[model samples]
Target chain A: MRKSMRITMILLMFLLFLLFLLFLSGCGDKIDLEEAAVPLAAGIDLDENNKLRFYVSNPVFGDKSNDVQQYNIPVTSLRESRSLQDAYTSGALEGRNYQVYVVGRKLLQHEDWFKILDVIFRDARNTVLDRMVAFDGPVEEMFAVKPKEQPPLPAILRGMVDSKSKRGTTVLTTLQDMHRQIYEEGLTPVLSEVDYDSKQKSFRLLGTALLTHKGKYAASLGYQESVLLNLLKKKATKGVNLSFAIPGEPNADVFELDRASFGIRKIKTKIVSSYSDNRFRFRVQMKVSAALTEQLFKYDIQKHADILEAQLTQQMQDQLEKLIRKFQRNRIDPVGFGIYARAYQYQHFKPLEEEWGEVFSHAEVDFDVHVKIISMGTIR
Target chain B: MNQLEKHSLSFLQFVFIIAGIQISIAVLSTPREVSLIAGTDGWITIIIGWLITSIPSFVVFKIMQRSSEGTILDLLRKKLGRWIAILFTLIMAVYLGAMAYIGLLRTLLIIRVWLLQNTSPFVVLLLLFIPTYIVAREGPKLLGRYAEVIFYFLFWLPLVYLLPMKQGRWLNLIPIAKEGWGPILSAVPGVLFAYTGFSVAFFLYPHLTNKQYAGVGILLANTITMATNLLIAIVCFMYFSPNEMVEINQPVITVLKTIQFKFVERIEVIFISLYIGIYSLVWIPCLYYMAYCLNWVRNGSGERKYLIGLLILIGIGTYIFIPTFNQSDWLEHHLTNFGIVVEYILPIAIWICLVINERMRQEGQPG
Candidate 1:
């Protein structure tokens, strides 16, 4: 009896292992890559009839050529848009591989426009690392261009925004970051802006679009100004290069031009704010290790170093003060000064948390800048 | 009848067993529940919860130390009457059996949602039970070894949470005590659920190799659990905004969604799938104790096969009956309250009874 029981146990174990293997190989619905339309990019815009329009782009490989298949549909829900796209395709449309989400300016005008994309963040399988870009015009115009000599539009747009942000010319905003910024009370959302430049006949990067706390489009900052904003926000540490002009003497042989161009390196920004008497006092301090990357006029570096440093500091102070005034004028705090105030001054800032933007608009700010020329571009 | 010396566990193994059971399913949503109550101060409530749960944990150890029988059930039979002992055994069996079943169901549900969305619940539970039965049938010594192995393998899981710190905002943690102590204090009960598995100490103490230092082992286990919960809470607090933190259903796993790699994306999917190992840790001990309680009543020798078959039947029944997620959530909510009564209140009540019985027996004797 014992021998027979041992034999029976071994057979049972073998049969269970076989069942395990069969189940491990999945018996129900499966994700088939070939039958799935791996979307490259998705765009949201408002139709001419004031309805929500969603567009998805997927790449198709052919026998003799490669092309991107585009699907445009007006829908009330984002998940339902996939089914609409499926009517024109041979495969199931999926959002798992989308590299970018393009939002038109018209769509962002609504206060709660961000609520529509809740499915992306809520779905367990959906990926949210895609780049989020805001187009100045209708998103369809940007999608209509099929660069004859380049890769897909999504790859091009992602590459363009990524490289520009790395060079401190613009900001890179992902869907995850945008989600946090939209909800964070101390910070506001800033999306990388893109537009179709009709003059150049191609899509172009247009710095950053600043949004209010409710995610409404407030204003747009230019490329140069975006770099400054990034520096102030500490997003750009080493790659910032600022171009400024120094007034030149017309009579001097070497200083014939009206102004001379120079760049600032190693830019460091500090914001010191204190709340008292229902108002915030901000002391903006900046220190830069500068260099003369280009000079249209000749001046001795060692002889005029002190004068240039002083003049550069003055110019930076003027420009920084102007930028602060513009932020105050628009009543936007893109630099996240409210974040610092709440962290450093908890008791004083807690009561004013909800009205922080309005309080920032009425606050008094002063600029104190220090610039030191460390090198003259590999020259004396 | 088993020998007492043959089933003893070392001190570290005791600690690992308690810590493993405490951490399994609670860590998945502990941060979110705490944040919903206390906001950014949720970590503080976790510390408070750990200290409060330690009282019952010590009471369990003290009661076990006073017993000379092989197990808690045997002691109950020796001190109390046979009827009372049988009553307590049934209560414990039902409690532990429910715990094991709910834990397995939740694990399978998460796997279905996060990792294997296409797989059937029955198939998933079948594969999950294989490892659990294999490890648990060998008893506490091998269970200890399994817990230790899973711990060492998954110790790096917390380190993965630190990757989200790149997007963290230190400002979100500020304005400390902004919501005041009321919210933080109220959140302690929610945090206590994370520390609920400590009641396993009642069953585990009689098997300890060094009973003298069981106190230190219990405290060490609680400390490990508290530190894990605190780490995840603080990371989630800093990574997500206050409003956003409350919105997240599972802050620990959702925070992992931000982690990306060039070679492999969606690391959380892989993490949740591998988390099946740790999930089995909780069910193994619970199922073993449940069967052990039944054997106490029946005086049986082959509890292993019966326990494994019972667990499979329960898993299949729950899968068929509780076919939807909302029903599972509703059942889990009720079970969590039941878990509090068994894990929190039962130990202290038993300790009180043991004290009263000892005093009454001393009075009855000629002193």
Candidate 2:
């Protein structure tokens, strides 16, 4: 009896193993690589008739005709457009591999435009690590401009924005970061801006698109102002080169220009928050250590370093003050002064937290900058 | 029926058995749950929660110390009455079964959502029961070994959660106590529920090779649990902004979604799949205790029949009437409350009765 029971137990184990192999190897939801349509980039734009247009650029595999297969359709929902897009594409649309989400300026003009991208953050399978970019023109025209010598538009655009962002010429805004910016009262959203020029047949990397707290397009910052913004935000710790025109340049040629460039080795920014009178007051202190990279006009540096440093400090202060005034004019706090205020002064800032942008517009801010030339470039 | 069941668990096994059970489904969502009540000060609630649980934990140890050779049922039958012992056994048997049942269903729901979406949950439960039958049939001895193996095996998993904090904002933790102590204290009771499984020490103390170190063992288990909870909570707070902490659901796992590498991506999926080992640590032992309670009522042998019957019943019952995710959440809500009554309230109540009974016996003997 014992031998028979032992034999039966082994047979039962085999049966269970067979059952596992049968049911556990799922055929119901498995999608092979060829069957999945992985979108490299997705664009959201509002058409002239106020209809939402969704665009996805999917990489085509094993097809010699073209490397990328583009699809666009007018739809009310992003997920719903996948079914609509199936009319032209062979594979199932998957958002798992999305590398970028491009939002047009036209859609960004609306106050509630950010609510549409909720699906990306809500879904468990979808990724939110992709860059969030803003287009200055209609997104449809961008799809039309395909350079013959370059890779697909999505790859080119991702590479360009990534490199530029590294060089501190543009902002790199991920979907996760954008989500925080939209909901966080302390700061506003800033997307890396791009504009396609039809005559030049090229895409231009415009610095950064500034949005109000409600995600509406407030203003645009050029490359230089974006660098200044980067300095204040302390994002560019390295590779920050500033070109300033010095007064001591001698006219050597008909097209002689007085210019000096320096690479920043280190920068320290401090914001002091104090509330007095009718408006909140802020004292901005910055110390910049730089290495002189190029100089067109000759001057003795060792003896009069203080005067040169003072002059550079004055120029940087005026530029920073102008940027702060511009932010105040637009009622935007891209420098995250409100973040510091909430962190350092929570009790006083609680009542005004809802409309901090308006409160900040009337606030007083003074900039104090000091520049020190730490080193000069070595000549071979 | 069982001769060699004595001296089954060493000191290390005893400590790990309690710690493994404490890190159940609660660890995954504790950050979001506590932040909902305490805001950015959620981590402070964990310290207070540990202190509160430490009281009930001591009471449980005292009750177990009164009868080190047997379960609380044996002590009740000897000191009180058969009626009281039967009642306690029935209540605990049902409570333990329900906890194990709900824990299994919750694990299945998590697996279906995160790991296997298309596979049948029935199949998943059946497959889960195979290993459960293997470990639970022999009772606490095997359960102790399972705990030790799992605790050491997955020791590095929690360390993986620490990597993402390199980008976390330490300033989010600054200007602490923004909302005052009221909300932080309110979140304490909720965190106390996560520390509930230490109550399993009632059954485990008898199997211990050294009853003298039982107190030290329980304290070590609680410390291990506290350290794990504090680590995950602090990481979630430091990595996510205060606003983002409240917005994201299951920030523990969802935070890992952003972690990327050149070789492998979507590390959370792999993390969840491997987390199945830790999830099994909760239910397998509880199922054994449920069967043990039934054997205690019968006053019979530690036969394998009881465990086999309970396992088959659960495997088939769940297949016939599948539990949905929402139902599992509802079950979890009631289970935590029921666990507090059993793990927290019952020990203190029983200890009072034992004290009164012992005092009456002394008076009858001397006077």
Q: Which candidate ranks first by DockQ, i.e. highest?
A: 1
Best by TM-score: 2
Compose the digit string of candidate 1's lDDT tens values, residues A136-208.
9988777777666677889988998989998777888888888888877767789999998787777789999
TM-score of each: 0.92, 0.93
* lDDT (tens digit, per residue) of candidate 2 on A152-230: 7887788878898877888888887788777677777899999987777788899999999999999999887888898
| Model 1 chain B lowest lDDT segment of ten | B318-327
lDDT by residue for model 1 over B1-367, one digit each (tens)? 2555677788888998889878885878788888887889888899888889888888878888876547787777887778888898888888878777767877877887777777677767766766777777778888888888889899888778778986787767776776789999998877787777777777777888788788788888899989888888889998998878877777788888888898887888888876787788778988988888888788888678668678667766866765466776677667778877887888888888888998999998976
Per model, kept true contacts as a fraction are 0.58, 0.38
| Candidate 2 lDDT tens digits, B138-250 | 77888888999998889888888778887665666667878899999988777877787887788888788788888888888888888888888888887777777888867
| Poorly placed runs, candidate 2 (over 4 Å) | A1-25, A63-66, A247-256, B1-7
Let me know the TM-score candidate 2 reaches against the reference structure: 0.93
Error of 2 at A150 (Å): 1.2
